[model samples]
Target: MNEEVENAFLPMTSVSSGKGSLVIHDVYCYTNQIVNICFINIPNNKWVLIDAGMPKSAEKIIQGAEKQFGKGSWPEAIILTHGHFDHIGSVEALAELWNIPVYAHQLEFPYLTGEQDYPPGDPSVDGGLVSEMSPLFPNHSIDITEKLNPLPADGTVPLLSDWKWIHTPGHTPGHISLFREKDQTLIAGDAFVTVDQESLYKVMTQKKEINGPPAYFTMDWDEAKVSVQTLRDLQPELAITGHGVPMSGNELTRELNKLAENFDTLARPDSKT
Candidate 1:
């Protein structure tokens, strides 16, 4: 593991809510500004991980899980909202170690099964250093064909019945978000991010700002705009995005609305490659 990553994921303070059965674990990665990996703890020792974070953060992820569920308790399965390198860096390693199955949208199969490489990040298209440095982001596919399963035909994700998977692509061809209708908790992948991920300073400080997906990897600007609007219509009460701290209540709702209304202006690509 990289020294920076080792320090970044050092065991974080854990919090549990007595009112509800849900538990959320946040894991941070030190590269490309700040990357957050979230794990939702449900019943029966089963947990749902939203994204995989940067490479080698798996050890820390497992450690976080153990902190909540006790040592040696691995998730029944791992569900990915997308297949971006940061989100999938440690997927194969973690899945192999735990001998667990992995789930993703069928549209994301090309990347996960080593069938296709996502288009390279467009650094010149955005001004932020993260975008300028995006050429460094990995675009190679992972060969996890055997352990992968597609979302159920009914659109309900396994182990998460109350939640529905929303195909919020554009950040990547098959990126997705998870939504629980009952209480409206959204786990937005990269369709839209709650932080200006390209700004290293803002990331390190944990500043709150809702913005488009990480500019480095976002391919289709128009599609991305529509996706953000679609998610806003859901009016999620709480959102845990791929980056930034999880947000909730009227504040999130207000930001989402503003994003949807001005998507073309705010989410448009800075330049065409």
Candidate 2:
């Protein structure tokens, strides 16, 4: 009953966006300066919303879903990759709006149920504006107890027949990535990203490059490295990440492999140990 919602909304500028197929479409929220929210199309008119976007984005997400699926449409459930503020900023609002169940890994429950806060972002890790502003980003946990549910222990995602949730930690204790084995399509949360999150200019431009999680928020570099390798081992042909554009084929393979091999040099921050 006591859910914390952000009062101030980040100013945004609209930008271009696209989809992989009818099965998956993402709306770029906060104009393209923030995170992406995905809508996974189920067999019937039903669909699933993956990771709510920034503060005050529930309307944008709802409108985008209506435009893609149809007017007066609502998803069956909401699946979260993690409880990062950006990912779940509007979750409490949207969950109440639609009165749907929200699922997340059990390890993430503390953050979602208002029991704990995430570790502070390390501004000393990098010198860019985003890094400089890291200290201001919300690190408090939200209380969405009534609507929250733990993911199935067997790793099967409800409502999504073909996709499975893979435990991919490091960025957060309970981070998970969604994968469709048939097409090897991966919905990589912050387990790994396709952009240099340390740079504001690249994030604003929405660059396409394989990299590790956002440096400032990642608490376990070793786990992050292992998590990247775990995903690389999956050999996902196509990957839609928490940031940047989607990538696939041999190019994605090549860059991902390189990132996995040279993670310390390319993705790890200077102060993390």
* Winning model by TM-score: 2
Per-prediction CA RMSD (Å)? 5.5, 2.7
Steric clash pairs (candidate 1): none
**Candidate 1 residue lDDT tens string, 1-273:** 222222332211112211112323322222222555666656775776666666666776676667666888887778898988777777877888988889999989998887788877677765876677666667777788878999886779888767888888778778888888878888888888777777656655667789988887887877888899999999998887777767789999999999999987776764742
Q: Each model's C-alpha lDDT?
A: 0.72, 0.82
Runs with alpha carbons beyond 4 Å of true place in candidate 2? 1-5, 8-33
Candidate closest to the true structure, highest lDDT: 2
What does candidate 2's lDDT look like per residue over 60-86, in tens digits? Answer: 778787777788899899999999888
lDDT of 2: 0.82
